[model samples]
Target: MIQRLLIIFIYFTGVSNSTAGQGQATLVVTGSVHGQLDPCG
Candidate 1:
């Protein structure tokens, strides 16, 4: 039981970290596109 819990905890931590990084990357990409297209606005 303890091993299972540890595995789950590690899995979720990794997923969360990857997801956070992806979210940040997406935001940066979108922001760059927006800035280019709406430079005059």
Candidate 2:
């Protein structure tokens, strides 16, 4: 469905933005993991 695709797009965009930081790769990974888990928990 269109809604599902839109959600996926937005989720990836957020992930991309979060991972674009400099000198903080671990923070990015931690943020992405938390983002994915906290929503379902």
Would you estimate the TM-scores of all the predictions?
0.44, 0.43
Model 2 residue 23 lDDT?
32
Tens digit of per-residue lDDT, candidate 1, span 1-41 = 45654564565556557866666555654565565567583
**Model 2, residue 25: C-alpha shift (Å):** 14
| Candidate 2 lDDT, 1-41, residue by residue in tens | 45654565566666667756433644545565666667673
TM-score of 2: 0.43
Flag regions of model 2 displaced more than 4 Å. Answer: 20-41
TM-score between model 1 and native: 0.44
Looking at candidate 1, the ten consecutive residues that score lowest on lDDT are: 1-10
